[model samples]
Target: MSTGQVLDQVMDIDEVDLTVDTEVDVNCISKHRSKVHQHFTKIENKFQCNHCKKTFNIEKYGCTSNRLKHLNSKHPSKVEKDQTHALTQKNVILQAFQKQQKNQSEADLQRLITRFIILTDQPFVITEAQSFFELMAFGKTNAPAIPSADTIRRKIFAVYDEEKLKISQKLQSAPGKISLGADCWTAATGKSFHGILASWIDADWNFQQVGLDFDILNGNHKGKSLAASMFKVMNEYGIASKLMAITTDNASNTDTMFLELQKILSEN
Candidate 1:
């Protein structure tokens, strides 16, 4: 500021006596210059209200509580608007969380439906049970929607495929060769069947065994068809080359099938 501006703003200048015996004190001029410097160097503490777009500072008449009191008294509409906006944002977050929970419940229920279908080996189109499940879940918060029979069936098949892949991976990673035991038999209904089992000693030297397949012998259980079915399971498990031995009953067809399988294995 110019000298006149500083002189006009400094209250001490008005209190000075312009007597004939004394001039302006040099210390007073220095003090006024310090005041100007302090004015420029001062750190302002101010906050702006979001909703009202108004600024307030707490430097003069107490702390920030006065600014807050003034804001509430003068701009209540702006405070209400901010409160409403905050409530809206909270509701949005709540809705997103609820939606996520609903989706998770739906996924779990679909897996449960698949288990129900496969473990029971029941037809999917049991309308009575379907309606019962729907009624049970009705008006329940975050409950899964009851799907149609076809949808449940599809989920069951998908679960089957995923489990098959896991088991195949285990077979491929088995430490030693797997032994095979096959049997052909006539069921009570006179339907022909052939069953295959895989056995092996695991890394811990524990004996492990599982049924590989149980196929209906609609056609003749000749060497070619028997070999085809067995090999299909082996190849699917990626363990065809690790076959240690095959055992079956002393039937003529069984011997033929073994001979054919031997030739196929040797050739490959």
Candidate 2:
């Protein structure tokens, strides 16, 4: 909208005095390369003007419309070149997005592979199978290649340890005393298993529960066996001092288990 002679020099954005009353935050722009800022950035739809420091909601008025109005009125030459500059920058931004997307896709692959292994009871080495690679390759995912079985295994263990730590902290930080529920059963394979879970309200008053232990019972389901397993979980999370009550089905052994637990908790 400027005069022809001044507009002719619009090609060089570097000359524009893009200075503001206050500096514009990098987040004030979409995740695109900015000629003026020259940084990777993304902003909320509502942004404050860099020159005026006035707040505007891009969604209510329109995304980028306020920006355009400012550019056209204050720096028409810059506006004249914005479309071309944005076009030139598009390819560069796209390449960056592609690279980021590929990495995220690969991480998702690791999680999916872990879930598949657990749910299907498949061996850890199944990841190295040729059919898995072929199936994933045909899906056209951005993941560059199928991870080796060992890589998937490492990822699974890393994720498990991280989650375990989080659960431990949550139990230790329970807003109130925590309650426990436990169960024991023998599987069709004739292997005995026992599991324990903790339940408590969070600081925000939201009830939450998480399994603290699920392990094979190598010995008979005696009171001593149950007490040992329960003690292990409580000790791991340091929740013995915070335990409010323990719940179990009407089993004779469970009654004995509580008596044994009381002795252990008292001695500690």
Candidate 3:
């Protein structure tokens, strides 16, 4: 063949190979590109923005970093109190609502009670409910009342006591080696009392206070009554075994109690 004709034939063969290779490469690239595009589309559809009440295409907010930022920028006026103070105020409102439901009709009290509960439990304070009447009459067209701080305090204590008892029971039921810690002090009445505390490590390796009892002992530091009081708390909590340790200050009665505890453990 002539030189020009030979060069043309070589070029035709090279073009044929290039065309076949490019088609395969193009198909593989197209497949991966389609997968990447679908993955992002799915993520965009699921996420929504809590602030601005806008439904976003992504799984999380694209504009702000966190809920706090959304609240500060979008809901500025409503975010007046810090998180802790707002929670405390909500607790006060819920307590008042729970107290007022006893003597009143449910139909008459539902809105006020529900509002009080929501305000008290939420992380914001719409308004304060200081008393039963105040809580009930709140948001009424004619008049509104505010609860007293004293009443709020009393309601909080009621909840506190109930929680304390539940915690004590949970500690008693826990299975593990327990310990007793004791401290002493003189009250304002000039009477001396010993405070005994029992504790144990839970499954999560956290030390929990299982039981506590205070006893007023007549200047007699070495009295059997103190030992009895300690034993009473242990028995009430159903702690039948000798604890791993008993921690207390240097007192003759405390020493005696340890010796007695040792004897009890030995018997078991």
Candidate 4:
């Protein structure tokens, strides 16, 4: 054939191929776009699957192929639902997950509130205050309701007991004897009380101090009375045998208290 005829044939074939390619692309775009979008949401520039919440980049992938592939492989049944139904289903699933997470965090949140109250010296009734509720709501939109004041008091005692047990165990396992400190004072309410603290060196050679007791001392703050109160705390913690030294103010009664403690120790 002559060159012009050959060139004409080549041009005709190229035109047919281009037309077929263009038609196929248009068909794919029209048919797959709605189907793919049914199970996915376009957020910003990414398509996130409603069922799985997996995001596909719109810039790199042009929004349909990756999403369709994700639907077919990961969520085959979800692709058949209409757009509105799929979106509602996604919201339901997400809400359920968030609710479950919130429920799980409630105990932790309560403990944190207890710690906050203790650290701030706030009254337990603070939990019942509307201002506190507003503060909590301001911090978290779905914050759990604050427990009643009585409930908070019980939690405080429970935490105290748990920590006391832990401290008792630590004192029991201490490598060295525990040093005891005691002070007798009258509270603002004119109630006499004895406060006892314990200091010890741990197996790790770390010095640890813990408040052991702050019990009401009904009678006099004399030597024998203070000795008995301090020893009671030591016996309660199972640490009377681990006493290294007693520390107190240089009152004449403190000397007698030490003598009384020695007599008691010798007798025990």
Candidate 5:
């Protein structure tokens, strides 16, 4: 018999043979069509050729490889612009972060200044305040920007003067005979100096310093001049006769001055 006739006869004898043939044909068609669709889809998604402005299939050439070829051939300016844009974005982000950090630092400095004023009860000049903020912001060991020493000196002097006034008022009200102490020394600047200190016995009977003064002697250490300055200080404080006794560190010049001071007081 002929092969076609024999196959038909076999199919007619068993329907299962016909069903197997149909299944095989369907699977074969699906595989063939699937490969074609994949190839065309890749081609459709590919970038246009930079030199020719032509569309090409990436199935034959990979996307990255094709882009590299285009850059080397014709799109150098486009690549440069992309790189520049990325760098610019990065720089912008960095600058913004720095500005945010700077603002936070300023806020911290202001808070610290406020706390210092409250704790110390002292007012700071603008330059001193700036220096203090810099120290706190950077570190205690960090070198500060140069500031005018005169300005800092003025602020310190003002605070000291105010404190001195308060202390003097307290001393005026304190009861008891205050002792007077005097001394002389040469300053580092080669100037002769005389210092007078007032001390009082408190309720507990311990001597406490109540007032002090330093006089620049212009290189003179004479007993008379030192005694005159001491008397002036005592008279100003209305305590010339109120001193119970005077103390010194065994200097001959101070002993002579004390003897002169006693004679002056006796005559007065």
Candidate 6:
């Protein structure tokens, strides 16, 4: 059997919906033609032969018969016929794919771990639990190494910063005025924090919302104090001038907060 046929059996290539969560590259390759792929360079919608620099369109499912015919007719000497060498070459390709799959799986595991810790408000040390290790080892023989508490902390902060950057860019490009809603609450530890959310319609007419700030309230939760903190968040995103409206609970402090914000806006 050809290397492509063997790869098809190993990977079990099947037609799948693109809408579903799937690795299109691994599962959608035409007939598992990694052997042909190794000799050709992909150029946009076509693959270019490395030897002749001629490009060919991929048939419906990634068929590379034209490329194979070219190689057989024009580069016959390069084609190996010995089954033993063909098997070794197949192993090499499979090993490359295995290494790539391992790296990809490791990255996905890290992201899942990061999201679990952040969304659950769990401590970074949760990754160090015996149960966590056993859970990772449940199905797989060789589970990827769990990151240390410090590593998890770093990853969390990195993700936070990266997401914040995305939100900032979106806010900058929003088509209409950005509306803001803010609330303050005390955590179980008695430490107070204020969260501000900004919402706006994008150029595509899609409504978008993002948390601009969720930081510790330094001094007091009074109107002036809250106004000061909110101002900083708006200024950081450079959206103070584009503010369409502000929303907060109907409290005496909120009325005072708006008044103070208006004064601050005028002074700027």
- The lDDT values for all models are 0.64, 0.71, 0.52, 0.73, 0.58, 0.75
For each candidate, give its TM-score against the true structure: 0.55, 0.55, 0.39, 0.57, 0.44, 0.55
Q: Model 3: per-residue lDDT, tens digit, 1-268? A: 3434433433322111112223233322222211122212222233333334544433233222333355566666545544454466555554444444343554334345444544577322223534555554653423323434444444445655776678667766667877888777777888878787777777787877744667787665563555656666677666656456768888777777767755664664
lDDT of 1 by residue, 107-167 (tens): 7877776687688887777523856676645545456676678888788778878887876
Candidate 4 residues 1-268, lDDT tens each? 4434433443322111112223234433333325565566667656677787877765544436766677778876666554566566555555554555576466787898889887888899998999988887763545566787897898899988998999999999998899988888887888888899999888988889989999888776788888888778888899988888888888888888888988887887
- For model 5, the local distance difference test gives 0.58
> Which candidate's TM-score is highest?
4
Q: What residue pairs clash in candidate 1, if any at all?
A: none
- RMSD to the native, candidate 2? 17.3
Kindly report which residue pairs in candidate 5 clash with one another. Answer: none
- The residue pairs in collision within model 6 are none
lDDT at position 213, candidate 2? 81
Query: What is residue 240's positional error in candidate 1, in angstroms?
Result: 1.6
lDDT ranking of the models = 6, 4, 2, 1, 5, 3
Candidate 6 per-residue lDDT, tens place, 107-186, comes to: 67788899999999999999999998888766444446778889899999999899888888888888789999999988
lDDT of 4: 0.73
Off by over 4 Å in 5: 1-148, 204-206, 259-268
Q: Judged by TM-score relative to the true structure, which candidate is superior, 5 or 6?
A: 6
| Deviation of model 5 at 130, angstroms | 11
Q: Residue 70 error for model 1, in Å?
A: 55
Q: Give the higher-TM-score candidate: 3 or 4.
A: 4
Per-residue lDDT of 1-268 in model 2, one digit per residue for the tens? 2223333443344433223223354344333233433311224654555554555654442334456666568767765586677666554454554555565666676788887886787888887888877887663535565677798778778877888999988887787999999999989888888999999999999989889889788777898889988998899889998999999999999989999998998998
lDDT of 6: 0.75
Between candidates 1 and 3, name the one with more favorable TM-score: 1
RMSD for all candidates, in order, please. Answer: 20.3, 17.3, 24.2, 17.0, 23.7, 17.3
